[model samples]
Target: MDGAEREVATLLEQLQGLTSNAEQVEGFRRVQEIVQHRDPSGAERRVLRGALPLLGQIVQLRNAALVTSILQLVAQEASSASSTVTTASAETLDVAAALSAGLYEVCHTVLLLSHSTEKNVVLALQLALGSLHSTFEVALRAETVENGLDTEPRRAWDAATRCLEAAAGIVAIVPEATGSDSNRSAMVWLRAWKFVESGVMLLSTAQDSSVYRDPARSNIQPNTWSLDRLSAGTQAILPKTKLEEFGVMLLKAMCEAVTSKSDNRLPLQRRELSVAVNSLSLLASLRPQHMPNILPKLTALSTVVATPGTEDPVVQKSLTANLVKLLSHPSAQVFADEVTDILIAVGASQRAFSAISKSKEQRRKYTSAPTEASLRRARIGKRTATQSITERVENANAHAKRRRVNLSESSATPIPAEKHWQLKKVRSECVILGSGETQDSKHRAKNNQHWCQFLMK
Candidate 1:
């Protein structure tokens, strides 16, 4: 086993040392064969651990195959952090360390350009970023690390911020990459924002209740991303520079979503935009300077969706009330005078102003009472084919499951066995003559249909 490790390491070095582009490509393929064909105990992890660094080697070569191999490896191997080398172990930083500027530049270039766009590349990039964010999320939330460093701003944290940048930068380019999946782009935005969101939540203890919150969020599970819920450190300071970069990227993403109206106008995509508005509002409250950058986009949010109300959050809070909750959040002090006129321009109702004075409970009072969140996701009057199939399967399983005796509907006492039918049955010699019932039957118990069975005759 030691010999095999040496052999793999030796092969990797030789692969990197090769100057000829053609031979290096061949050598790269050979390395994959050696690791995987040899049937190592953890072939995927080994291949990934060995291949991730290979990305830098091929960056100058411009070989999509090599880049794709590493990405596909990361996509497949990094999904389960428990088994992969990227897990939150002592060597956890290894994976983050390998996310070189070369890798980011390559991914960013491929993701941003339509002609260069590849689905495999996109999928792999999404998986890689999401996995890294989730992985470091634990360390950031830890009370203290093994290295005695602060929760964030360390090597691991620095790499995590890189992941946020990479993800958000891809989000900014999603509109231009005409062939890329809009859904995937939205997901990347969500992942990037969530990483930032957790960081802020951990640092901001005083403002938890003060922020404009979605009531539906109260019912959902908190985004811990860890098995044993590690809360954030209130005193942990976030890097102001990187935090501002996230706000900037979020604004870019929101702009792209609007510009690509044909692709992003659906309820789901619009819902994502609404969440971004709320998130920007949250960031602005913490840092007032973000308000100026975020306000125009919030006004552009005149196109809010109707569903997802009272779900994770009411989109822009107005989407929760279908245009009623677009109040002037305190973050909008810069444009306080224009908010009402803007809301009016966007077709917001009289309730938009009236609801401002309402209390938190009262703010949501005007929420569409009919649009209840079913199955914890608020969707109404809309069902895709997949959702229809899912609902059917769920309903079938629900019907097959046994009901509690206490909760089951009581039997109707046989509906009193209609007296007219009973009298007619008696005339036809088919009256029941059970011991508890009337024994005034016209026929013996054996002859009565009430006591009959499918006898063999």
Candidate 2:
């Protein structure tokens, strides 16, 4: 690497060390100087990007005192810049965007940490309101509301619907207005609402309530990219798949599948549903492709049956009332003649009747990432021979005899499709970046190249 790049790389390592309280002051002081003295147009911009890890660390700290301090600092600096600041630099808007994003991501993450104390949660919400306050105040002086933050780690926008709605419903928004004249109760609520949408969008990118996660959904392990053919990331993927984009889609579609309007039927995006079932059938050596559209309907029903918070045992019973229902009903024959966990999850009393678990072991061989494939192959092979014998036995029993029988017999049947799901575990082990080493590691790795210190910690 060139000398300039090496210098920037070194800066990232130093920044990560700014985590303790004493170092924090120095961190902010440097930040203050950057916002106050540097321009975004040149090499200083790289410094700004490199500096974000400290900001990320700040958000992770969850100390109300620190959050408030940074909030006020960013707001004060942006507002104090001269009106001519618009022509001289894009500083106000950029800083405001960064602060808003930081606030939203941190608050949203904190609320999701089921392990956090009530105090931390309250502080997070308060930080949220402070962020909102800065958002609107910035509007009073800043020219635009467009975001200029990096998009790695992807914002949780799709999950922000509720926050946006609540922000819109607040009463007595704008007030009477004039030039810094009246001691204030005279501000324009209407103009404030104009920025409200943008403001809401900014916060909702995170601070999005619908996306709140339980600590149950956090990361399982770090992906340490090593040189040897041996790798270990596969064990990490399966647990969190259901919380991914497609998994969320699967969850949403199943929840909406059979409304009161559709008694005998279940609805789903047949295309995506096929991709999923197809993968399962192909892997299990079953032929679900025979009734492409027909089987997925049953599969969607199975998902709804397994989804957490679905309390009505009647739904499970209605599905189980008769044996013929098992074969002829929509979900019964999902993959040709195979009776499977797909049926068991819905309370099928008889033998599970399908073969899906054993086939999953084969999944290791097909993994494509060289590192991950090696990792899985080595771990599963070795672990299976000795350490994983019990786990392997448990894996088989999970699909075969014990749980399936109990499920068929009891009304309290919750087929253990995925372990550790919430409200009784619906198989949602997503990689939550709320607060922990995993969050810090992933966030750093995501921004490391262009904007961070070190790869994922």
Candidate 3:
């Protein structure tokens, strides 16, 4: 090796030996100097190439001082204005892969150090996780339509999956990360879920074959990539059965989180609950039968809704609507009547009844009763409103049935013809209301219309 190469290698070895944080920082500064010089010499290039992997090793060791030093080098290297520095490839993969690897290493380090009793180590780990999340966000934005469709997409998927799996592993090892005291962990998990949600949204959009065709020609911006592709890639590395098992494990974790009686209100737990609800919603869309499996957890969530004066109206609405939809399913009829009763009780409060009564009283006091002109006017108005509502309800049901049929036909390959037919039957059994001709039918029709709209929306 040349003199510069020898010098870099020696510095790297020496950096590894530095026991003190100050010494490690100094060593990293020196390495940054050599890398910044843009020396094309063999030694400098080799050392620059070697830095990432070696840093990765340091991260695995859970050496806070070493990880910080490595991050400093990366930040410095990243900040250089020279085109050579900016364009300088890692001799690893592109910037995406390098960033992903760095994130993976950081996650591993954080998981390892999360158990440390030392406050500083934990704090450092949290900082590193935040840095890693920011880096991934940058990488995620840099993805283009071409890159999203090519090998880069797969790498992106793998990287994200790795980060999520690592986070899950960390939480498993250190349950305290999801506990009330660890705001950092809560933030980390929230960031991860945001990424995952973005991924799922992208996948849902990309499932349209038209999106992939002429990826560059389309106006569709590549904001996110497919989770199915990510899951498939992970399944290839892991096993299909194992992937299914992992999904079940996540569901179990969610169930525990929902049911756990702890008073500790961690933001991570809330984030996890949101993730779990979205996941359950996705699974219900994919496999309606699985809705029953998650019903108990949904029921637990409903109790939260049942709690009065919660500031989260959105969460309450989502939980109640989801429960109602599940109950409306044919397989869930055992709880359908119960859900209907709850909806009635919640929807028709004394306030609403009082408002209706006050309006009737005002009408009676202001206008003469039993007048033919007023009665005819009211009849015409009611008929028009009833007709409009009937049309809307019919249109919505038609749209929903069409969606169910399309989804069923699309999966005809995996689903037995008998089962597919059964699904259609269950879907048909879901009642759709028409315009009412009688007072009792009108009330029942309005209730059915209201419930259907709530569930469909």
What are the per-residue Cα lDDT tens digits for candidate 1 across 1-457?
A: 4454557667767866767767766776766676555636452244445544545444434455555665554444444432343344434433433333224444444444444324544554654455554444534433244553342224444554455555555545432223354424555556545544444433222232233343223432222331224333332424444444554555555445433244235424544556655665554443334456655655545433322331223454543342233343443444644666655654554655664544224233212223345533545356688989999999887766644342344332232346545545644764446667644443464455542222111
Q: What is the C-alpha RMSD of each candidate to the true structure, in Å?
A: 11.0, 32.3, 25.0
Looking at model 3, residue 166 earns an lDDT score of 52
Candidate 1 collision pairs: none
1-457 in candidate 3: lDDT tens per residue?
5565567677877877767767776776776777667446432344455565666555544355655556555544432211232233333224444444444454445444544323333443443444433343333333422222224323533554555455444333213454544524554444434433333233232333222211111222332332333333323232345444544554444444445353333222444565656555544433333445566666656555456543245665665555554443334454554555555665733433333333233121111124677667777677877788998899999999999997677656475676556555544554555664666766665665555444332
Model 2 reaches what TM-score against the true structure?
0.25
Q: Relative to the unseen true structure, what is the C-alpha lDDT of residue 231 in candidate 3, on a scale of 0 to 100? A: 35
The predicted structure with the larger lDDT, 1 or 2, is 1
Name the best candidate (by lDDT). 3
Clash pairs, model 2 backbone: 174-189, 175-187, 175-189, 176-186, 231-375, 339-353, 339-354, 421-425, 422-425
Give per-residue CA lDDT, model 2, range 1-457, as digits (tens): 3443345445435645656765655655655565446544342244444444455555455344455555455334323432232343345444444444544555554444434344444444444544443443333223232342223212212212222323232212222234442211122222222223233222211211112111101221111111111222331211223223332332223223232224443232333223333222221121111234334444555555545644345444433332222343232334534435455655552534422322222222211224666677776776645567788778898778876686566545443433222313211222335555565666554543322111111
Ranking by lDDT: 3, 1, 2
TM-score of predicted structure 3: 0.45
Tell me how many clashing residue pairs each candidate has.
Answer: 0, 9, 1
- Which candidate ranks first by TM-score, i.e. highest? 1
Please give the lDDT score at residue 344 for candidate 2. 61
